[model samples]
Target: MVRQIASRLFYAIVILLGVILVVSSLVKLVPGDPVDVLAAGNPAMTVADMEVLRERMGLNRSVPEQFVAYLGQAVQGDLGTSIRQGVPVMTLILERLPATVELALWAVVLASVIAIPLGVLTALKRGTWVDYVGTFVAVLGVSMPGFLLAVLMILWFSVELRWLPASGYRGSALAAFGQAIIERDPAVFWNAFRYFILPAISLAFVMIAVNARLIRSAMLEVLEQDYITFAAAKGVPGFVIVIRHALRNALLPVVTIVGLQLGALLSGTVVIETVFAWPGIGRLAVDAIHVRDYPVIQAVVLVSALLFIVINLVVDGLYRVIDPRVRDD
Candidate 1:
């Protein structure tokens, strides 16, 4: 198991190196001078001045030299300062990381809570109205784009019902909880949860639908397997048979979906945050792109790529836990 984990970690390192190479090159690959975009409305800036600025920013270096310099700086945790924001790239990402983390965490939690059991029940009750309803929900969820859902949710829940905040993440849950403790006002925690719900749901609904379908199919297949049949023949309790035997086998594919979707959920925050005015890393990336903030863009891309790789590694570990045979395999 340790060897397998070590092998995966080595591969993850190699993949991250590739990501850094690609992410670092993204600015050069894009057409047009990012400096020109940055200098827009500065009528006094001359070509000479622009050249000087470019040289200072290391755009004048050969690609290989620039890459080496970037790797060297990155090793020391300096991802470069955002020309647009005039702040260190890592600092900006860290400032907003908690909000993004909060949103993504809630989204995934909501999705798994709703999808897993619904899927298992749907599969168990296949060929009935319950299954049909579940299928309809999955289709509806998958069909609707997240932005559209965000808009509709804001309209219905925020405007019409006035039940929840339409958008914007305040302080994180911990902060809210701390405030609750400090002030003896439990409403702080609820307020935090309330502020989180719409955006999280908007982001998660599609994933929930997708995960449900995957779980349903996996469960159906597992339920039809020889082990399941033997367990049934042994007169195991139906609930025990489903929970202990069937559910465990069915989880591998679902785990894969969850792992992959975590990255998707993170990226999807860009749209959700834009719609809801939530301050997160994704929204920061959008602003960076608009201003041609190369350092910020590169940092965001690399961070996201790292997140995807890390989630997959965790998923690989989960595979071993879910089925010990996977370790040997």
Candidate 2:
């Protein structure tokens, strides 16, 4: 296991380096230079002035030289400054990371808590009305895009009902929880909950459907295995037979999907974040793209790629834990 983990870590490092190179290269390919954006409103700025700024920013260097210098700086955790904002790219990401993390956690928790049980119930009650309805709902969830659902939710819940905020993340939920503890205020918890609910639901809806469908399929497959038949013949309780015997085996694939979705969610909530005005990495990336901030865009993509690699690595370790057979493989 130690050797396997070390190998995976090495691969992860290599993949991250490739991601940095690809993203940095692609950002350069984007039309409209950052220099052009910066010089837009400044009538007095000559082409000579812009050339000086470019040299100062090291944009005058060849692409390969820039990439090498970027790699050297990145090793020391210096990801470079944003072209537009002029702040360190890493600093902006760190400030926004917590919000994205919080949003992703909320999304995953909501999807898992709802989908797992629904899937189990549907599997156990196959061919019944419950199963039929669940399958239909899952299909509906998958068919609709998250942004559309978010808009509908805002219109119905936020606009009409006034239940939750339509957009915006006030701050990290952990900070809210800490404040709740310090001030002994329950409303802080509620306030955070209200702020998070809409976006979480929006982000989670499709994943919840996907998880439910996958879990159902896995459970059905596990239930048909010889061991499940043996358990049934031994007069095991139905719930135990399902939960202990079937669910454990079924969870291998479900865990894989969960890992993939969770990883994607951490960095891929661009639409939901934009719709809800959530201050996350996704929104930051979007802002950077609009202004052609190459440094910020590269930094954000690299951070996201690293996150995805870490999540998959953790998931790989989990596979060995959940199924000892995986360790042998």
Candidate 3:
């Protein structure tokens, strides 16, 4: 296990370096100079002043030299200053990360709570209308685009019904709960939930569909195994056999799906966040890209890649816990 983790860490470092190099190279290829963006807002700036600023920000350096410098600073936990905001990239990321994390967590939790049981039921009732309906829903979810779903949801829930706010983010439920405990106010939690529902559901819809399908397929396979048949032959209760024996074994694939989708959700929330006007890293990254804020853009990509790597490592570790066969191997 220790060796596995060490190997994964080594690979993760390599991947992060590649991500940094790629992002740094690509940002330069983007039209319109960061220095020009800076000078645009300041009309008093002359061409010589722009050149001085460019040299000062190290934009005049070759790509390889800039990448080396940036990588060095990044190694020391300095992501450098954002060209647009003139603030530390890490500070901007940290400020917005909690919202993104909260949204992703809520989305995954909601997906798991619904998908796993629905999948199980569909598999168990394979020939019934329940199976047909679950399959239909899963197909619809997988086919529907997240941004479109988010917009439709806003029109239905926020515009037509006016049941929820159309746009804006309150603090996350966990943060609100802490505040509620301190201030003896429960309204904080409710506010967070209300703000969370639309965006979380939109983000989770595809994951739920995908996970449910995967789980259903896994459960079907698991239920057909010799041990499952033996359990029934031994007079095991149907529910116990299904839950304890079938579901437990079937969850390996579900874990993998959830881990990967959770990572995707973290990085792919850009459109949803923009639509909802949510104050998260995805939106921040989008804004940074408009002006080619290299530090902020690179930091967001790096952070998202790091999260993806870490989640996969966690999923690998979970394999042993979920299946004894993995540990034995």
Clashes of each: 0, 0, 0
Model 1, span 250-301: residue lDDT tens: 9999899888988777655788899999989999999988877788888888
Tell me the whole-model lDDT of each prediction, alpha carbons only. Answer: 0.87, 0.88, 0.92
Which runs of model 2 end up more than 4 angstroms from their true locations?
181-184
Ranking by lDDT: 3, 2, 1
Residue 40, model 1, lDDT: 79
* Model 2 lDDT per residue over 1-329, tens place: 67777888898999988988887677777887888888896778899999998898887787788888899999999999988888899999999988998889999999999999999999989999999988998999999999999999999998999988898767777788889999999889778878889899988899889999888999999999999999889999999998888888889998898889888988899999899998889999999998888888888888999899989988887887888887634
Q: With candidate 1 superimposed using the best TM-score fit, by how many Å does residue 26's alpha carbon deviate from the native?
A: 2.8
Q: TM-score for each prediction? A: 0.94, 0.96, 0.97
Summed over model 2, clashes come to 0
Question: Which is the winner by lDDT between candidate 2 and candidate 3?
Answer: 3
Candidate 2 residue-wise lDDT at 137: 81
Q: Using alpha carbons, what is the TM-score of model 2?
A: 0.96
Expressed as tens digits, the lDDT of each residue in 1-329 for candidate 3 is 67767777998999999999999899889888888888888999999999898889898999999999999999999999988778899999999999999999999999999999999999999989999999999999989999999999999999999999999987778888898889898887888889999999999899889888899999999999999999999999999999999999999988988999999989889999999999999999999988878889899999999999999988988998999787623
